[model samples]
Target: MGDVVEMTSELGFKYSILASGSTGNSFYLETPEKKILVDAGLSGKKITSLLAEIDRDPSDLDAILVTHEHKDHIHGVGVLARKYGMDIYANEKTWQIMDSKNMLGKVDNSQKHIFSRGKLLTFGDIDIESFGVSHDAINPQFYRFMKDGKSFVMLTDTGYVSDRMAGLIENADGYLIESNHDIEILRAGSYPWSTKQRILSDQGHLCNEDGADAMIRTIGNKTKKIYLGHLSKENNIKELAYMTMENQLARADFGVGTDFKIFVTSPDTATPLTDI
Candidate 1:
């Protein structure tokens, strides 16, 4: 009898932050067979140019997934979807909230896919799982994407990381997590008491220490990269966030550039593409 042979191709995934931080948020993800966008917080013009910078065409995107209807996350969605004829996916409540606010202008109902918490959506060669997160939005959710055996998790804009969130992030190959503010600086700064309280609450954004704690708990030997994101313009500095996260991880016996790679994204400008 002749020997039988089976052939399989290795899967590849690549990601880049088109923009990050409170000023705006956008991320680009590409696998061998799909191109996906996480958010469109930047202006349409900027998003288009950023795609060019990364050697990708806006029209080539397979889909645009929205985490919430916050202005910083939906600012450019209308223009980008209209121009590229791309479909958008969000939860039913999120879509309803967006429509009530006229956030994305007039998107076709047929083009909007309503996703619910705990459901998995498939696109091209990737599978995406959306789970609820603590954020001030109509049913806010974070994403976990898996292709072949590699997985990536993106958790941002949450005030605190719950056990459920940590469970989702465990053993991820790549992570884009929030490190929004310094609690002491925010408390002493000029912002109103109400705003500060909101930011520090469970539904608000994560502070540096909180973010670092989450990273230390979730990171594993398979975690290849971590990008600190959504820094506050007033209370947080890039250096402070980076140093805090690095120091905390060191206490846990993980060193940056040795145990894993780390990077920071800016509110403006696209970060270089990273392959996983």
Candidate 2:
């Protein structure tokens, strides 16, 4: 938005989602001195190529943070970390569970870091808070990254947002929230009943209705942008997801473009780098 407030009061962090969906998921976060990735779901080669799209060097990454052990979230974590010699952080239970399953192949012990939920972590000038999320995976978390006075949250793969989740991310300047499916489209599609039920379940994914409602509740007055993400290719179209959220904002008397901005992420490619 031309007149909407940006990070004028303080320094803002850089953010971009390399991919977000059933196929893969990743987000890149950078402050002035630190560059980090959240999840390496795509192949290592593909991840690097996406980095090249933004003129970023994978070798320069400072760390990799995993949300969970799902293949779509961790498929490339081991390969990328080993190649770049960077450390990775995950909850201890997730780390132990993933390690036992041979998910990441053989990362060195030193490369593995454990961060408990509800703790404040610092990397350079960046401040991160990892809060528990309602996902099926063991010890899943959604992250909010802050630098200076601005913050953004990379939130996905959660079945629902709890009061705590809403509280943790309500003040972010930007949000990458999951808008996984359209309920009507999903129910009318050809998927089996069980698959549909699973997705509709609390531990499955967030539908467009719930996602939009969450966005409406969580955004602070100064929140600048909201990116609808993790859409299902089979059930949800990007336009539908975007419009659903936009309509919600409009219904609340908020100007969609002038008061705030919105973007949708693709399953196939990375979104343009976002300045928070």
Candidate 3:
């Protein structure tokens, strides 16, 4: 924890995992000149409160970026945008699905912005880019934010990380990736066989082992922080997810507290603000 604080204090950008899991998912990122919310999965009031927990205000956010149209990813998007009058950016396919389902309510034309998949866009002092991820949603994607020489990747809900996907986000200073379930637990748990199959499918969520492998393939000399997010309350234990990552990275010659630090995100609370 002390190491985390020391490293964060030395950096120019900070971020926190507001909430992460099946119930809801949101992330808050702050640069010297910009405040960004990657997703608002909780209610508008809840997100505002989460922001306040970290001494931020909803109205001060420069933009709200959407990765996909899943309810757990966009539940509060419309309300946040409407209430704060902030710009919301998403891919055209995501916007189409959200609009078709009325998922974001009534966002004004001025508040809706679209960016092409895999293209880079600048927001304030940050450079943001989105890339395709394998997930069961209309054009599901994730983002990598770069400012100065540091980069942070917000990646979740993807079932598999192809070499290409890993390459795009490689060498990021920090990452927030899903370590959703333990295969053994999911296979033995009582989530209906079909649901289990879906989660185990190619378009489903990444299990703990896969998530760890993704991190191993992406970690570089500059990587210092890793956030294991989107755990399954029924299928995964926080400690188990953390250990899985720690153990796997260890085999690859990475030390948990020395090479980099690991943070396990929660569905009900905010993680410590970290910078990299």
Candidate 4:
């Protein structure tokens, strides 16, 4: 994606996707005092290049936060952390799963702060609130980050939006929500029945309609940016997902690009830095 300049000059939370979607998932979040990485799904080389693209280096990251133990989320976590000597933070279940699978590199256990569901944890200048998301994992959690009076929520790998998740995401300045698939397309596509069922199950990925519905329910006046992420390459298209969300938001009296900026992140490359 091309760089989109910020229209507003005011300083706020800055976010960038080093990579997103099925190929890989990584994000960089910058507060006034801390620079953090949300995931490291991409390769170490790719992550380094993406950081350089944004005029940053791997050593600059204060910490690397993981959402789950999925390969797509932890592909380069070990490499990056070992290279930069950065900490990896996640919930106890996540850490346990990773440890059981021998996925972590050599690092200080104290640095691997185990986050609790619905509890707030402070890391540098950012306060992170992680909650359980509907996904097939030992303990997959979505995150809500607050810093400098601005808040943003990042929710992906979710199958359905629970009322609790909606409440947590509402009224944020930015949202990185999943728009994983188109149900009809997925159904008609040539996949095994069991595989398709898993994709449609409550523990699977969210459909486009589900995502749009959640956006309508949770978005507030303070929501300034919305990025549709983790889209399926086979079952969904960027234009279709964008149009679906745009039309749905229109019905809710919110105009895209006017009420809030809309962006789509790539699974293989870094998206432009977005500042709220």
Give the alpha carbon lDDT tens digit for every residue of 1-276 in model 4: 999987754456778877778878988988767888988988899889988877788888888988999989998998888788888888888999898788876666666777777788987667899889988988898799887678989989988998978987788998888999998999999989898999899999988889988999899889888989999898889899888899888887886788798888788767777776
Candidate 3 C-alpha lDDT tens digits along 38-96:
88999999998888888889989988899999889889999989888899999999999
Clashing pairs in 3: none
Please identify model 3 stretches exceeding 4 Å from their true place. 1-11
Flag regions of model 1 displaced more than 4 Å.
Answer: 1-10
Model 1: pairs clashing at backbone N, Cα or C within 3 Å: 159-204
- For all candidates in order, the CA lDDT equals 0.88, 0.89, 0.90, 0.86
Expressed as tens digits, the lDDT of each residue in 1-276 for candidate 2 is: 488765553378788888999899989988778999999999999999989888898999999999999999999999998899999999999998998899999999999999788778998889899998887888898789988788888888888888778987896888999999999999999999999988998888999989988887788787888888889999999999998999988898877899789998887688888788
How does model 3 score by TM-score? 0.94
Candidate 3 lDDT (Cα, 0 to 1): 0.90
Off by over 4 Å in 2: 1-10
lDDT of 1 by residue, 1-276 (tens): 898887745475888889888888999999888888998998999888888888888999978999999989989998888888898999999998999889999887777888787789988888999988888898998899998778888899898888877987798888998999998899999999999999999999999999999998899888988989999999998999999998898888886788688788788878888777
The residue pairs found clashing in candidate 4 are 20-267
Q: How far off is residue 206 in model 1, in Å?
A: 0.5
